[model samples]
Target chain A: MTALEKKFVSFSVAVAVLFGVPQTVSAMHIMEGYLPPAYCVAWGAVCLPFLAVGIITMRRLVRQQRKTMLLLAMAGAFVFVISSLKIPSVTGSCSHMTGTGLGAILFGVPVTTILGVIVLLFQALLLAHGGLTTLGANTCSMAIAGPLLTWGLYQIGKKLRVPRLPLIFLASMLGDLFTYCVTSLQLALAYPSAQGGVGASMTEFLLVFAPTQLPLAVIEGLLTMLVIMGLETYAKTELHELREGRRGLFHDAE
Target chain B: MTRNKKIVVVSLLIVVLLIAGPLLALKGASFGGSDDAGSVKVEEITGGEAEPWATPVLEQLIGGELPGEVESLFFCLQTALGVGVLAFGFGYLVARKKYGGDRSGTAGDKEKNS
Candidate 1:
């Protein structure tokens, strides 16, 4: 075929492909019923301890300082907003932000864990984005593991005296990346490669997720930094109180 | 806009660019969900035997899968609820700073002491 004709044909083919199929709105959350029953139960069992801790921490914060309830709601809202946005990525696949990092940074791991699970539960039931059966697995990756890493990174960065913005950015971004990594590992564990085993299967899932997730992580990090800056600007007193309360609580633990 | 407002606007623009840049650059690519991609891989690995074992409750109740529009509506509602709560929180903070004045500090201190 001549060059112009070939170009025309390829353009038509692309248009056809785009319009031909009915698009299913699958999302980043492992879809409902995706995992086997045993795997689902196991993942749920693993999350129970974290959920318990999150509940206790949240209850204590609300009871001790009533003002924190509003902040906690805001944190949950942040997760909801960030995760709901499925931004397009370089891989030509869409993914979402965890938004757990901001909560973890602001409120710490246990409260963020609760926020993440709540968001996941809402997404699963209301939007059918994630499944009820797979809620445990999703909670493990998105809520518990992601926020834990973000909180740990934030703590370490604070101790190291890193600048606030960069530290928040790194913690949020890396936390997001780590969540996807955990997700890949979860999927690989359930369905190991016959030829190459779990390692190979994990590598495959990681490759599939990485391109979409990397850019998303950066966006999430930037957005989180901005939100933190905004909070510092407008809610200085509340933020200060939260910090003091966190320190006091830690001291009590020690 | 003030300096902080300017920064927020620029950062938001950058975020917009980050999302839009990929779509403009990668013409004709279907920006499918990564989860869908992961599921496809699972299906491939399992030789097409890795079907989802349960239906979403909504789908089950409806006796069919949700149409794309219905799904989008649900997503929009979710976003609306979140944005509403966020707006309320920020507005409350700003109002407290502006009008509540000493009352804000006194209330906060009371909570702290208690």
Candidate 2:
């Protein structure tokens, strides 16, 4: 195939991947039925308002930049590709990139969030990767929590006048790390330690995951930055309009 | 080459370096994920015999593990569907913007007035 074809293919595939982790340590999506019904319900409930907001945000974005629709689609496809590719982490577990933050950064928190929930749901049903019950928790960490972090960081980056690429790298990295941290905490809450209880359990999960998650976060961050740069070149007009639309949003708020 | 073209080329090179750099550096290494670590961590904290609070609903429904190939096929199909929906959706939006003109920009216009 031609280089153009390859680039298009990668555009669909390579938004995020890497720093890597061991699958045995913690898989990408919490497997089906991994969380108790109560945890599932609680997490699912937590996701509702975010998703509602996301739906609203998505509509607004479509109106703001017609080309944003394409960006949104590409973002979703990117998430699917990255999450599906199981990478070998240094620690001997098969892990995958969350790709949540990049979506959030590109499309805004709400729409990227909805995309995450839908993608997770699809993974649960189609690939048997994650279960239906744990959808809420998975969505919460990967979609809601991670993207929120990205949006906040992105805003801060804008205010601080940080170079766009570096800011994106940092935001993407933090977003990926935050997801693992939340997932670990979720697991910790479910099963507290013998002596120190929940805190200890949380600590234990963090320690175990840190070995892989730390590097993976860095890899993901760089990957996200590179992808955005690519978009800057290929999708310049859409990005410019989108940036203008976002600026108008904040400007209006003031 | 144009600036955009140069950046795209450099970006591709960077991507190639990322993938290859790691493979070479981490040769003979073990790569894995936390799928089972969460469970093991729970077990260690609670002591052995820590039963899973949940089990795979799909597994119970299917009565056993689905073949790996079947699972992979589903994943591929899901990716294709996701790509198709997103591409088509975006294409429609672009076309609409091209023909319909820019009514959406009206909202941003208000910002200028204030």
Which structure among the candidates has the greatest TM-score? 1
Q: What's the C-alpha lDDT at position A247 in model 2?
A: 35
List model 2 lDDT by residue over A126-223, tens digit each: 66677788887888789878888888899889899998877998998898888888888888777777788777888888877766676667667776
Number of backbone-clashing residue pairs for each candidate, in the order shown: 0, 32
- What is the per-residue lDDT of model 2 for residues B1-114, given as tens digits with 9 covering 90 to 100? 986567557755755565555556787765444766766776777677566565565666788887788887877777677567656645654564666534454555567557
Off by over 4 Å in 1: A1-28, A247-254, B1-6, B100-104, B107-114
lDDT of each: 0.80, 0.69
Kindly report which residue stretches of model 2 are placed more than 4 angstroms away from their true locations once superposed.
Answer: A1-28, A247-254, B1-32, B79-114
lDDT by residue for model 1 (A1-254), tens:
33553464455445433532222101137889898787676677666655655665676677666767887898899998989888899999898899998888877775776788888888887777888999978987998788878888888898999988889989999999999998998888888899999889989999999888998998999999898887887788778768777752111221
Worst 10 residues of 1 chain A by lDDT: A19-28
TM-score of chain B of each: 0.81, 0.56
- Candidate 1 residue A62 Cα shift, in angstroms, is 1.5
